[model samples]
Target: MTESSLSISVLLVCRDSAETSLITEVMRKFGISVRHSVETEALELVKYQKFEAAVVDFNVPLASMILDQLHGSASNKTAVTFAILNGKSGRASSLKVRASFVLHRPLSPSLMYRTLQAAYGMILHERRRYFRCPIVVPVTLQKGAESEKTSAHSVNISQNGLAVSTPVPLGPGTSVAAQFKLPQLPPTIAAEAAVRWYRDGKAGLLFLSLDPSLRSELSEWLSRRMEAFLRPVQ
Candidate 1:
């Protein structure tokens, strides 16, 4: 995405009424957008939606529920979460659960800013590696080490990769050759791509090598998509 379009939006799940507003203000002061609500509403949001990153007060009543629902077991994980460690019962045990980062009480502005900065950095890095924009295209996928071909549908295309839902998932880091046609283009786009990630039947493919001509075509396609993204909607 373009610099103007890129933003860091985090889910805030703190219960301290004063600190909740204060935290939101702090995020805005750092130029990071924050989405927050009452503890009840926030819990509901985390249950069904994923955020770029989530900052949560692990001391709240619904904290564990949020974690279990959003960052659960391996097959159910969604978003990276940062929890504030409050010294309460079961706090130490909760440490066993997965969290991007955890901090103790008595927060400072600089510390908070830096923490979120880290979270944003992590999010951006993940995006660069596997982030995708919406697109639909048919792809003929062939594993680099295998001769079998699999039919797949590209759901979103990104700078480094594309997300595809196929009948079978290509193992992560497996090199592959792909042939596909993007919308609004004249020629077929083909590249040596590597499977960067996979879950269920969907996988992310990172283009490892793009010849000059194909690179030029892909760049043009990306530029067009970015322009459309920047265009104001009616």
Candidate 2:
């Protein structure tokens, strides 16, 4: 799948009204279309609908209930799941339930976006590895000088940077420009990146000029891609 081809569905459950608004606002700013549902509805929806990932507020009263539903036998168990930890609970306990990632309270939009991107990227990377695709996408280090375009393929992607395949590998300190096309969105949205590494068609590119809105759009695109990929191939 190409970068533009990505789409994601996120389930946001929060007991605190302020937190909910903050999350929704960030997602909206990024142009991530979301489905707002109560905890009960969200859990049931997970059984049938395909969501790229889910964001749950572990601070809510129903947090444990939601967790059980996510880990329950009825769950499809494919979508990536994230929990917002208030720091009262131990990470060890959360890890046991298979929460892919956790975020602490007093959240920032940037942090939330980055965490989600990382979790999703990790999930996709594992899937691709399991399928053994000859081409792997990189998930980190996607920014550098604009003059020189380096050849690379993404091993995985996040809002910040992407892992790429590099030719004429350089060392860790080396720098260059990175360019690649995302799948569905316009090629005009191509990422201008900075090279973070150089090694055998594999390197990192940090996005040079992505803002909150662009990040949201990218998130939405990834969510959609996840749904499409998880769908039964017809």
- lDDT (10s digit) by residue, model 1, range 64-181: 7777766653322646677877546546766675678876667777777777666755654433333345777899998854588889999788777788888976788889898888
TM values, all candidates: 0.51, 0.45
Report every candidate's CA lDDT: 0.70, 0.58
Error of 2 at 130 (Å): 16
Where model 2 places Cα greater than 4 Å from the true spot, the runs are: 1-6, 29-31, 72-75, 88-93, 122-234
| Superposed Cα deviation of residue 150, candidate 1 (Å) | 25
TM-score of 2: 0.45
Clashes of each: 0, 44
- Candidate 1's C-alpha runs over 4 A off are 1-6, 29-31, 73-78, 87-94, 128-234
After aligning candidate 1 to the native by TM-score, how far in Å is the CA of 2 from where it should be?
A: 13
Q: Worst 10-residue stretch by lDDT in candidate 2? A: 126-135
